[model samples]
Target: MHDSRAVPFVCPIDHGVLEAHGDWLVCVQCAQRYPVVGGKPVLLNEANSVFRIADYTGGNAYGGASAYGTAGDGSRGLKRLYHRIVYTLSESGAGPAAPFSASDAVAAVQAADPDAQILIIGAGETSYAGNITYTDVAFGKNVRCIADAHDLPFADGSFDLVVACAVLEHVADPARCVAEMWRVLKSDGRAYAETPFLQPVHMREYDFTRFTFLGHRRLFRFFDQIEAGISSGPGMSIAFVLRTTLANSTEHRALGAVLHLAGLVLSYPLRLLDHIFTRSNGAYDSASAHYFFGQKRETAIPDRDILQFYRGA
Candidate 1:
C-alpha cells in the first residue's frame, strides 16, 4: 500500500523537492538526476554506494542454473538448491520459523501511520505487487518505491515512514543508514524496522552483521519509542543449520527432502513432545525472531540509560 506519488519527495543533496524525469528522477533543488533502472531508484550517497552480499552459500544458486548441468566447484549450485529447499520447507510449514524480517516491520509502521509517506531501504530485486511488499490484496496503494537503504533519494523530512528490513546487516556502515532514516522522517514520524537477532551466513551481496536484542535496541537511540521483540533460539538455530547443511550436499538433498517430510509428519507430535518435555533441547531452545521499532517524536527525547545500555551500531 505504498503510494510513490502521494507524498512529495525531496532531493537529498539540496533538500529540494524531486520530480520524475523520464528514465531519471530529478531533484528540483540541486538538479541532481538519479537513474531509475528496472523500476528501482538508486539513491546511494558518495560515502556508501557500492554494496555487495557476502558469499555465505558458496555460490550454489548461480552455479546450478545451467540446464545442461554444472561444472567447476558446484558448491554455488548446491547452496542455491539448498535455499530452494528451504523455501519449499517454509511453504510446507516444515523447518524452523520462516525467514520473517523487515516486511513485518513495514506492516507495523503502516498500521501506526496509515497515510504517511513510506520508503523501503535496500528495496533489492523485490516486487511490491506480487512479492513481500504490500500486495494489491493488502493495501490498495500503500507503498510508493523500494529504494536503497543507504542512499535515499527523497529530501530530508519528506517521508512519514521508512522501513529498513534485514538490510542493515549488509550495509558497510549501519550507523550512517540509521542516521539517514532519521533525517528522512518528519519530526514526529516513526519508522518500523527489524534486523536479524539470530541468523547464519547470508550473502545479500554481503552479510556483514547480526544483532542481539540489546544490540537492536541500542541502534535506534535517536527515536522516542524503542521496543525489542524476541527472535530465533538454539533449537531453531540447530534446525536451520542442520537442514541447510544437509540440503547443500548433493547426496543429502534427496535425503533432506525425506527428512523434511518426516519433520513435517512428526511436527505435530514433536510439538506435543515439546510440550510434555519442556526441558528437552528442542523445547528448551525456543526463540522468536526479534523485531524492534522506534517512533520519532518532537518533544520526547532519548534516555541516557537506554542509549548507553543498547547502543550498538
Candidate 2:
C-alpha cells in the first residue's frame, strides 16, 4: 500500500522525478535506483542511512548488534532496548507528544486543509496524523519512505502541509533543514515543527544542538507565525536534565541506564507540574521544548531583520 502511495517521490540530491522500477524508485534524471524495503521506499541521499533499522541492528530483526560483535552503530541491542524502555515508562520523548508536543501541528494542517497532500518529516518513529504521508531517512515502524530533513525528496511547492516534530536537533544543520521544509511547501502551505531546548543529549552523538526560544522563530523566518510557545515547561526540563545527567555521567552505560530509569520514576511525576509552569512568564528560560506553527509565504524573511525576533541574546 505504501509503495503505491510513494508515486510522487523525487531525488533528494538532484530533485529529479522518480518512477517505480520493480521494488525501487528510480530517478529519471540520474537513474539512481532506490530500493523499497517493506513497501516503503528507501530514498536516502546516502546509501548508508543512519536511521535504517537494519544498519543499526547488524542485520538482526531485534536490533541487537552487540550479540553479533559490533560496536560502531552507536548502540547495542541491550542499550537500545534500555533506552526504549526508560523512554516508554517515563513517557519522556521527542515524538509528536509532550515536551516537543504535536497539538499545534496536527491542528494547523487538519484545520487549514484536511485533504491536502501532507509530508511528515522524521515519521519513522511515530505517525503525526492519520491523514499524513510519512517519510524519514529509513523505513521504520510507520514511515512511508526514506527522507532527510536537510534535503527533502519532494518537488518544490508540492505539499500543502508539512509537519516535523522533535526533529531539528537531530539534523546536523537546523537552518538548512528548515529551509528545505520551506522549499517543499506551497506558497500557501503551512509548516509545524518542535524541538527540545533544555533536554540532555539524546540519540547519543546524533544530538547536535538545542535552540533558545527566539532561535526557533528565526529557523522558520520564511513563514508567518501562527502560534509559537512552550510545549513542555520548566518542570519537565528539570526532570529530563536530572535523569540524563545521571545516565550519562558514569562510564558504565548499562548501569547508567538502570540508574536513569530508576530516576525517571521520580521525574515522571514532575510532568504534572508542567501544567502550572507552562503558563508562567519565564517559561522560555526553562521550558523543555517549544513548538512553531506557521504558514508559508512567497516572500522570504530578510536576514538582517531576523535579529529582532531574538528573545535571548
Candidate 3:
C-alpha cells in the first residue's frame, strides 16, 4: 500500500516545498501556484512542458471528454474491444521472456527496507505493492498525480527506487528525463527502464525516440549497471514491422485494421525465433526492446568505457 504522506511534494520550477492552500499548492520558496484536481496535485512546469496546469484543472485535458470514451457514452465497451483486438494481433507469436522481473526488483528493494519509497513514471495501469507513487503525463484511474518526466515535481533524492518502463521513447528529451530520474533517486538508489529499439511508432505524436542495447546503457551512464540486455528480441521487431507496413498500406481504418490483423496472423510464428536469436551476441543489434537496471553513482561511466561494453556482432 502506497502512503502519499511519505514523500513531500515540491515545486517543479525551483524545487521549493509546497503547502496546500485551498484547492492550490503554493510553493514556500518560489510561491508558484499549482492546482489540486480531484485531490491529486497537478504539479507541472508549464514553461518547460507541452502540458499546462489549466489543461487538467479547467477540464480541457481530453477536450472535456475522455479520449477512450466514457461509460455514459456507451463507447467504453467499444474502446475495450478495440484494445483487445490490438492486443490479440500484436501478441500472436511467442515473444522473448523479459530479462528481469520488475516484481523481483521491487521485492529486493523491500527486503532491504520494508518502507522503501518507490516511484513509477508512466505507470499506466500497472500496480505494485509497498510504498509506491504512480505518476503519468495523462490522468488515469491508477495515476496518483500528473507529472512530466522532463521536469519531475519531487525533491531531490526522495525515492528509493524509480521505475520508468516503456516511457523513455515517448519523452522529447530522454537524456533530460533520465537526469530527472537520477535527481529524484536517493544516493545509491536503484533505477529500472525499458525502452523500444526496433519497434515502429505506436503513440503517434508522442513517440520520439528509440535506443540500441548499448545506447540504452549509455543513457543511464550516471548509474552503475546492475543488469542490461534485450527484453524483446528480433522476432518482435519483425512482427511489428510487418504489422505496421500492412496497416499503413490502406487508408481505410477498417481495412487497415484487417490488414494489421492479417499481418500478425501471418508473422506470429516468426516470433518464436526470438528464443534462438536472443542466445546470440548479435541479437543486441536487432532487439525489439531493451531494459536497464542500475544503481545511482556520483560519477558517470566514461564514453570510451561505454563503447567497449557493446556486445553486438
Query: Of the candidates shown, which would achieve the greatest TM-score relative to the real structure?
Result: 3
How do the residues 93-156 of candidate 3 rate in per-residue lDDT, one tens digit apiece? 4876776856767888889888899998987666887889888877766677788898899999
Give the best candidate by lDDT.
Answer: 3
lDDT of 1 by residue, 23-126 (tens): 77787767877655445443434445552111111222121111212222245576767545545544343224423445555566557755556665544333
Residue 42 Cα positional deviation in candidate 1, in Å, after optimal superposition: 3.4
> How well does candidate 1 match the true structure in TM-score terms?
0.61
* lDDT, candidate 2, 1-313, per-residue tens: 2222332778877999888878778899999877776676666676433454344224432222112222223676877676567647666443223443465566656676655677778764565554567776544566676677877888899887788877898888888888888888888888888788999877666678998877788888889977777777788889888787877778996788677887787677677677766665677887788888889877778878876665431
Q: How far is candidate 1 from the true structure (C-alpha RMSD, Å)?
A: 8.5
Per-model TM-score on C-alpha atoms:
0.61, 0.80, 0.91
**Model 1 misplaced stretches (Cα beyond 4 Å):** 1-5, 19-22, 28-31, 38-40, 51-85, 91-113, 123-146, 247-288, 297-304, 307-313
Measured with C-alpha atoms, the lDDT of residue 290 in candidate 3 is 88
Evaluate all candidate structures by whole-model CA lDDT and list the values in order.
0.51, 0.71, 0.84
Provide backbone clash counts, one per model.
29, 1, 0
Off by over 4 Å in 3: 1-5, 62-82, 91-93
